[model samples]
Target: MTKAKRTAKKLHHIDRAMSETAAAERQSGPMRVLAAVNELSDQPPLIALSAATLAAGLVLRRPALTRGGARMLASHLLATAIKTAVKRSVDRTRPHSVDDGYDYRLEKGGSRSHHYSSFPSGHTAGAVAVARAAARTWPAHAPAAAVSATAVGAMQLPIGKHYAGDVIAGALIGYAAEAAVGAIEAAVLPAMTRRSAS
Candidate 1:
C-alpha cells in the first residue's frame, strides 16, 4: 500500500477503537439507567398502567380515551399471543443458554414452557405494542414513546435474555399487532357509530 493509504487505514482503526471505548463507557453510565426502565416492560407493571388508564377514561367519560386504554391492553394481548406461537414454532434457545453452537430446545406441554421461548422476546414485544397504541392515541408524544419502546427492547441484550435478532423480531411482531388492531378499529368503529346514530 502507498504511504498515504497506510496512514488513512491507521486513522480508521484509531477512530473505530475510540468509538468502541466511548460506547463501553456510555453503557456503564447512562445505559445502566435503562435497566430500571426495562423492568416496566414486565406484565404486572404494564397491566397496572393499563388499569389506571382505563379507570381514568371511565371516570372522565372520554370514549376515545377509554378506547385507547382498551387498545393498549388489546395490543399487548395480541403481541403476547404472537410471541408465544412464534417462540414455540421457532424453538430457539436464549443466548445465555447456548454452548458450542449446539444449544436447542422445543417448547413442550404448552405456553408456559420456557424451554424454547427465547428466539423472540415476549417482554420486548409487549412493550412496543403498548407504546404503539399510545402513539396512535396521542400523536404528540410519539417520539418519546418510541424511544422508550426501543430502549426496552434493546435492554434484552445487556440482560442476556435475548439475542439481537430476537429483539428485532419482537419489535416487528409488536408493530404488526398494533397495525392489525388499527385496521380493525378503522373498519368497525365507523359502522358502529353510524348504526348508533340511526
Candidate 2:
C-alpha cells in the first residue's frame, strides 16, 4: 500500500483502540452507577410502591388514590407478564454480546437465559406501565411521567442491556397493558358501584 494509505489505516486502528478503552472505562464508572440506579425500575420496588400507594389510599379514605394505586399495580403486573412471555418466545442477543454474531430466534424454543432474552426490555416495560397508569389518573403530570419513562428506556441502550428495537417494543407493550387495564376497570367499576349502591 502507499505511504498515505498506511498512515490512514494506522490512525483508524488507533482511534478504534481509544474508543474501546473509553468504553471500558465508562462501563466501570458512570455506566455502572446508572445501571445501579436503573435497578429501581425492577418489579419488587415497583410492586411495593403500588401497594404502599394503595395502603395510603385506604387509610386516608380516598377513592381516587385507591383507583390510581390499583391501576398502577395492574398495569405493571400485566406488562411484566407480557414481557416475560415475549422473552420466552423471541430470543435476541444483547448488544454487549453481539461480538459473536447476532443470534435471533422467534417463536422457536427461545430460552430465558439473560444473554438470549433481550428482545423486550423488562425495565422499560415496567417503568412505562407505571408511568402510563399514573398519567391516566393525573393528566397534569403526564409530561413528567412520560419523560421519566422515556429516560428509563433510553438508559437501557447506553448500558448495553437492550437494543433500540427492544426498548421500543417494551414501551409499546407497556402502553398496551395500561390501556387494557384501564378499559377493564372502566367496564367493571360502574357495575360494581351500582351493586354497592343497591
Candidate 3:
C-alpha cells in the first residue's frame, strides 16, 4: 500500500480505538462533569456573546479591535467553507455511526446526515480561525480568544463525534486560513484605504 493509504488506515484505527475508550469512560462522573462543562460553553447566550462583545468594541470606535473583529469574522467564514468542502470530499463516518455505544445525550435534533464525513470539524476550524485572526488584529485579546476557541472545540469531544486528532487538524487548518487572510488583508486593504483617503 502507498504511504498515504497507510496513514489513512492508521488514522482510522486510531479513531476507532479512541471511540471505544470514550465509550468506556462515558459514564464516569468526571467525564460527565466535563461533558456538562463543554455543553455549557456553547449555550445559546454564550454563543452569541462573542458577537456582542465584538460589536461593542466596534461601536466604541476602537480601530484595532474593530479591525480584529472584522478580520476574525472573515477568516472564520472562509475556514468554514474550506472545512465543509474537505469534509464532503473525504466523507468519513462520524464516531457515533461507527460506534453505537458512544454518548448521544447532547446530540442535536435534525442534525444533517453526518453518517459519512467527519474529518475536520467546522466548529473547531471556524473558532480557531477566528481566534487566530483576532490574535493578529488584537494581540492583547488573542489569548482570551484562543481559550474561547478551545472551549468551542472541546464541545465535540463528549459526543464522540470527532477524535482529538480531528480537532487538532481543524485547528491547524484554521490557523493557516487566518494567516492567508492576514496576508491578503495586509497586501490589499491598505492600498485601498490609501486610495479612498486621497
Candidate 4:
C-alpha cells in the first residue's frame, strides 16, 4: 500500500479505538455513580438556587451576597447562551446518537438539547463557572473549588453526555466567563462605590 493509504488505515483504527472506549465507559457498572453526579450537576436546580439566593440577598439587604448571586446568575446565562449558539452552528450529534458503528453526521436545526447539542457540556460549564467564581472570591479555598470543578468534568465522560474535547471546550468557555466577569467587576465596582460614597 502507498504511504497515504497506510496512514489513513492507522487513523481509522485509532478513531475506532477511541469510540469503543467511550462506549465501554458508559456501560461500566462500576462507574454508574457518574450518571448520578451528572444529573446533580445539571443547570436547572443550580440556577433555581442561585435565583433564591439573589432574592434573599435583596430582601435581607446584603450587598455582598447580592453581588455574588448576581455574578453566579450571570455566569450561568453566559455559558448557556454560548453553548446554545455553538451547538446550533456546529450541529454535532450526541455520541449515543452517533455510535452506530458507522460514521458521524452534522445535521441542521440543533434546537433539541438532549440529542443535538452535545458539543459543549452545559452542565460542566455551569459547574466550572460556579466553582471558578467561588475560587476567585475565596482564594484560600481555590484548591477545593478546583476539585469540585474537576469532579463535575469527570462525570461527563462515563455519563456519555460529551466527549473529552467537548468537556474541554465547555471548560474554556466557563473559565473565560469567570475572567470576563471579574474584569468587568474590577473596573466597574470601584467606580460605582466611589459614586455612592460621594
Best by TM-score: 2
After best superposition, candidate 2 residue 181: deviation in angstroms?
Answer: 0.3
- Tell me the whole-model lDDT of each prediction, alpha carbons only: 0.74, 0.82, 0.69, 0.73
lDDT of 4 by residue, 3-117 (tens): 9989976864564346447656676675676676577777897687667767878999997668777777777778777877777776555666566442454456545656666
lDDT by residue for model 1 (1-198), tens: 999989976874563344333334334655567556667788778777866787789999998789888888888889889987787677656544442243554334244445446768888888899899999999998998899888887677765456566778899999999899989999999999999999
lDDT of 2 by residue, 33-148 (tens): 98899899889989998888878889999988888899999999999999998888887776655534556433353476777887788889999999999999989999999999
Ranking by lDDT: 2, 1, 4, 3
**lDDT-superior candidate, 2 or 4:** 2
TM-score of each: 0.75, 0.82, 0.75, 0.80
Q: Highest lDDT: give the candidate number.
A: 2
Error (Å) of candidate 4 at residue 16 is 7.6
- lDDT of the structure predicted as candidate 3: 0.69
Least well predicted 10-residue stretch by lDDT in candidate 4:
101-110
The per-prediction CA RMSD against the true structure, in angstroms, equals 8.6, 8.6, 5.0, 4.2
lDDT by residue for model 3 (115-149), tens: 65567776778778877876787788878988988
List residue ranges in candidate 3 displaced over 4 A.
Answer: 27-54, 101-112
